[model samples]
Target: MSKNNSPDSIIRDITREFNTIVDSVSEESNFIHDRYFRFAFADPIRMAELLTLFSRRNASLKAFLDTIDLSSLRGARENHSTDKHIGSADLVFEVDLKNGGTTGLYVGIIAEHKSDKDKLVLNQISEYYHHLFLERKKDVPVIAFIVYNGEKDWNPLTETHFADYPEFYHDIGYPFKAIYLDVGHAIDDSEMKSLSPITLVALTAMKYICAKAQYTAPRSYRQVHLPLRLSA
Candidate 1:
């Protein structure tokens, strides 16, 4: 196959195209951020690549990703109910996994983009789990990814706690754990170089907006040209 037609090459091409779209947009708002994340990760291949790259440091997550059938990756409809106070996740995905040829094991991935510190972040994730549980009518495993691009050094899992429940901390256990990715730190991480072009560009743009500082692409991403063209 020609070099341009290789899998990695194709990914790069798509990444550039997406970047162009992002560059076309002028104003930045929560709606824009949500749309950008949903549009960028809607593609199963891109979603799989992102999960694999970010989950590498975590053994459990890495193992889970390994079992996922990439072909079976797809966006899942969000479930919402005002009566139950359940809210939708920024992005939800379902992927099938191989389990010794047993009945298919489907996993739910919840991606939440946080550009600021929210003390209620855990509660937000819990709502997602609750909604999914009700929708599936079964105990399905979920992996919540909190993608943070804010300037503050925040770790919800460590910094936040249930309200008035210090005594119940030991009694309470959540069915899902969150994987936090701080974009500022991620940009400096050498491992970021391994990320697909689209993922890298998205992170770079987020950091720029959140920091409100002069935007300079990391050296590794310079090949793609700094200040990548974005579109609405």
Candidate 2:
């Protein structure tokens, strides 16, 4: 039991360490207005630490890679200046997964941190997903995840898809799939138990702060729940 708890404790410790790393290396910070975003993606080294922390904390994501292999997995923060939006993904990179030494491939995971009180994250995630699609081929599985630290209890209203957004009227709008991981929705240990390792890592990351200040946190975790179901 003690050994089992060690990793979880380590995850929390790393969160503190990451905070320190960000404070020391971040170019600028405004805790009252941009506390969350500053904590997550402002520093490249902090971002790398976060990726490692999440991957290690979640068993499923860890199982997917079997072990950490920096030679294959690389993470970075890209400046995606688009006419459609102002913010870019907090973390973006290729993760190479080896399945029984027979199959090895790299899949992309785009992570966005949302920690505000507003619920306008749907549009942000939709835009990011579409942008990813435009840059990558259609065959590429660019999985999306939005981590939020506010509110709970969600049932996604997906029938009203991103197209329904009033701002995305033209052909410039991109379409892509996303998985929502809402930390607020984890009301109890059971729901947390139902969450996938990827989702678990996402939630753990969100508990700290948002990746960008421009985006609003969704009402719940409805946006990125697919990865949890897929992991199951």
Candidate 3:
């Protein structure tokens, strides 16, 4: 397979189907709510569930990447030490090829997901990228993505745009691509039909969270922190 962007048709169908399933699942689980879902440090279980969902999506993403020639597709690894704040992003992931004992192969990605408001994950991704830089000993091509399940449109207020956030000041040696995976966008009828189960779960969580976040306590970015361990 070649490394091509997902076909527009595929993207649309996947998004559409996913939205349908989420609506169905939410109804069955009685997961529908109107309050904003807060991703505080106190809610570790939700964080773990979110991480597991993301890892599952990463598998799908890898398959999508394979269609475009990306090799050595692998699973996700949560970097507990690299959480955005203390409880904001559930976890950061490192997805890469099977390590071949090479010093600088530059094949992995660093990612974060949020189900809460009040946290600037774009800035957080920047911080995590730096952490990876120090740990990996190389910029190593990094792809950063955020699965945001917020209700209202969260136009990023930072100097960071989704396409350029983590890569804003990154060197050419360490290329990065940032994308915002909006759950709302996933359920839009025009785009939800082809979404995989993993993406559907992400959107469902987003729907529930966004519904809950509206009335929750305001979360300060500085105090945001990811959990130390992922839930089972």
Candidate 4:
């Protein structure tokens, strides 16, 4: 493989690119934020790393992440259904389970990026789940995540009412509960220190760009970004 095409090189390049963008931005753009969010997680390895880090906080998710065969990670096909009600997920991945045996079993990880608050975001996520369920024939286990970088405090689960009949809520499971990561509040300096380069850059960029006021990267992050930029 070419030196520049190596995984290490790729991570550095992405970090540098993110640094360049975040350093120069004067105003926030949802489009730019969404694009960068998708770009950072486009690589299966990077996506896996981010999810694995996130799984550290949730025991059940960590167990599931441990079962994944990272080598088998790949981007899932984009939704092309003409149905107006259905929504496409920002990033979706399919990875085989380590104990799948001869037939091979896989699970889906869906990530949705939010640059702004949307009360109906869960509805959109539900649509994505429905679409994936139809395409995968409901056999694949799916886990969903919401990466929110908006300035406003928003929690879809607590803010939105899922159903009128609370009793029937447990019965309807088409859309799984998403683990919400509010970039502004979820990550801290201690957590940042242990993150992989790609995860560090991605989360740092999101936190910096989405802040209510002008923000600066921590000294450690700047030190990390410098080497990446020099290498790139």
Q: How many residue pairs clash in each candidate?
A: 8, 4, 35, 0
Candidate 1 yields a Cα-based lDDT of 0.64
Candidate 3 regions exceeding 4 Å error are 1-71, 75-106, 116-119, 157-175, 188-202, 212-232
lDDT-wise, the better of 3 and 4 is 4
Cα-lDDT of candidate 2:
0.45
Q: Mind giving the per-residue lDDT tens digits that candidate 3 earns over 1-232?
A: 1133355543444344334433433343222211122212113333333334344445654443443323333333433434223332334433344445454343545545444453565667766776666465765666665655656666443334444647765433324566555654344433323444333333444554455534332233122222221121
lDDT for 188 (candidate 3): 41
* Candidate 1 accuracy as TM-score: 0.70
Over 4 Å off, model 4: 1-3, 6-16, 19-26, 79-87, 100-103, 135-138, 163-173, 194-196, 212-232
Comparing 1 and 2 on TM-score, the stronger one? 1
Better of 1 and 2 by lDDT: 1
Taking the tens digit of each residue's C-alpha lDDT, what string does model 1 give over 43-152? Answer: 67777767776666656667777777767888776632332112478777787886565576788888887777888887888887887665568567787888787667
Quick one: best TM-score, which candidate? Answer: 4
Query: Which window of 10 residues has the lowest lDDT sum in candidate 2?
Result: 24-33
Ranking by lDDT: 4, 1, 2, 3
In model 4, what is the error at residue 84, expressed in angstroms? 22
Better of 1 and 3 by lDDT: 1
TM-score of each: 0.70, 0.43, 0.42, 0.73
